[model samples]
Target: MSSEAEGRFHIVDVSSLTSVHRRMPRRVTLRTDDGVRIEAVYEPSRASVTDTAVVLAHGFTGSVDRPAVRRAARAFAERGASVVTFSFRGHGGSGGLSTVGDREVLDLSAAVRWARELGHARVATVGFSMGGSVVLRHAALEAGTVDAVAAVSAPARWYYRGTAPMRRLHWVVTRPGGRLVGRYGLRTRIDRRAWDPVPLSPVEAVPLIAPVPLLIVHGDRDAYFPLDHPRSLAAAGGDAAELWLEPGMGHAENAADAELLARLGDWLVGG
Candidate 1:
């Protein structure tokens, strides 16, 4: 634990951006409809000039301070967009237990609402893995919630336990012992209850997000969800969606490279 704390100094590498101007992020606490306290941070663009803000949602077992998320946030900031990174309930300092992707929509909704309250005219919600699925559902459930949305490495449907990683994830999500490990070892709290009526699927939610810019980014070599998931989402999105099947990429936030993140940031801000 001591060693882990020592290596946890987060470094934001935005040295490439000219006229780099970083503002210390304002930490915030938000509440979900279900009464959970969401831990969040608002990172103003290093350029300090932008009306657009991007809300970043991390993957399963990931927090706002995760290196990949931090790197992505910095990259987005360098591109001149303010960023809001938050920990979903059960992750990091957020309250409540994880519902996996079931009730996580409320968590994303809270973050999105917070971003809007920060006085940004345009807000884009960018999510990875489980967060990816949450954003899709949030967009569908809450109309006019955001201007643009990006889902990276999301699953189209639920209950998919095909890949080895996913199979292991199922063990983590469905079993009591796994929840214990999640609580103690991973610092994640898994909810003991089950989804009463499994929430809307990502494919089902895509069509409803019409007129909003939607970018579905999936890695071709992803070991968790396959190409079929993103393809289904794109099909359901009709003309409102753009799909980027990245080559050589693996999965989620950690697998997302800096180049891909920079492009995503640009797209979010309409650059």
Candidate 2:
């Protein structure tokens, strides 16, 4: 990184980003309410912007610095919506271990605050996969923090070990040895503790998020939670929410194409 480029990065704490790719967004460090350090990037909107800030939540083991996350930010930025992307605790350059979907609401809430601090009057969130679940919970629990929320490829209910991918995921979070694989191989840290009382499931969280607009997006071919999860979320959300069942879309941020993001961006800034 050039000296001039280095000036753009904002160091919020002693922790810093280890690397930066070509044309990285403006970086800022954040601390979650639970004292977890979070790494986030801010991408300003292009011409014809609608003055709405869109905060993106990545899936399990994903960070704001990843290529796919950056690409998705660009997609939204190109649509004239300022975007914020962040890694949940235990992921990327952030501190702490993953609580999976639980406790991630603090991280999303922190990012949303950062977006508002950047001067955007309206805010929206679009989360993918595990991230998809986080946004729903955040909107429900926080309330009035965001104008709209979208959950893509999110499971409506929790503890769903039905799918092969989910079963494997359960193993990663539930087993001691699997945590090693997550830490060493995937660069993700898993929390060993289980959900004691269990948090509100996405389906249950959906109704509470209204009259905050909600959007549920899913792929017919998703390998994770399947179509029924999205259907359940849509059903729970009722008329205040919109559902999009993409034919070819697969799962999460990696599966999301530019066109789908553009449409989502439009919907977010519409209200």
Candidate 3:
């Protein structure tokens, strides 16, 4: 594999790394109906009444502090839109175990409601990988709740494309040598069947989000999720959705591309 491809697959410590100026994010807590409280970082827009707020959701096994998520939040904030980044349940500072994307959708729903209460008239959700699935599912479940949506490297057909690799990775990380951290919790504590992404697949949810401007961004070289997933979603949405295939870009490439940022910003501004 090429060096860039290698970097794309390797996971890094996003929370420890600092952005350009080493700025600290403003933090807050969002409480769910089930009484689960999640940690989130909020960055308000610089411009007056942008009419749109972007809620950033990280991927499975990812936290709000993940570098890509933080970068996206910062970029949206700089562009005059309120940005809220939060950890899904069992990910970072949040409580409870991860239910893959099923229960996480509730957490996202709560966050979106919180944003609405904060004077945001139109809400846009941006999610990466597993996070993408959550937002897409939310849009479908709660139609008319979100104004716009964007997802990067999100899986559409989960059973076939999603589980094989993640299951192996889970075993590797939760096994003896990597068991020092206790990140995924006991195997008995997690429902292996529930972790399947098929139940939360976005392929079935795309048609449900019709007429609600959707933007599906995926890299042509994405190793995790193939390009066809996003393309399928865009096709499902017909003219209602926009799909962008970043040339030579792999999964979660938005963190490093200005052009991707521009495309997202333009979509947000209804440009």
Cα lDDT for residue 21, model 3? 13
Q: Which pairs of residues collide in model 3?
A: none
After superposition of all CA atoms, the RMSD between model 2 and the true structure is: 6.2
- Rank candidates by TM-score, best first: 2, 1, 3
User: How well does each candidate superpose onto the true structure, as a TM-score?
Assistant: 0.90, 0.90, 0.79
Q: In model 1, what is the error at residue 203, expressed in angstroms?
A: 0.8
Estimate, for each residue in 156-269, the C-alpha lDDT of model 2 and write its tens digit.
Answer: 988889889999988888898888999898988887888877999989999999899889999998999888999999999999988999998898989988889888878877
Report lDDT (CA) for all predictions.
0.84, 0.83, 0.69
Q: Give the runs in model 1 whose Cα sits over 4 Å from its true position.
A: 1-24
Per-prediction backbone clash count: 1, 0, 0
- For residues 95-213, what per-residue lDDT tens digits would candidate 1 score against the true structure? 77888888788878877776766667798999999999989988888989899999999999999998999998888888989889898999988887778887899989999998899
Minimal lDDT window, size 10, model 1:
1-10
RMSD of each predicted structure: 6.7, 6.2, 9.3
Ordering by lDDT: 1, 2, 3
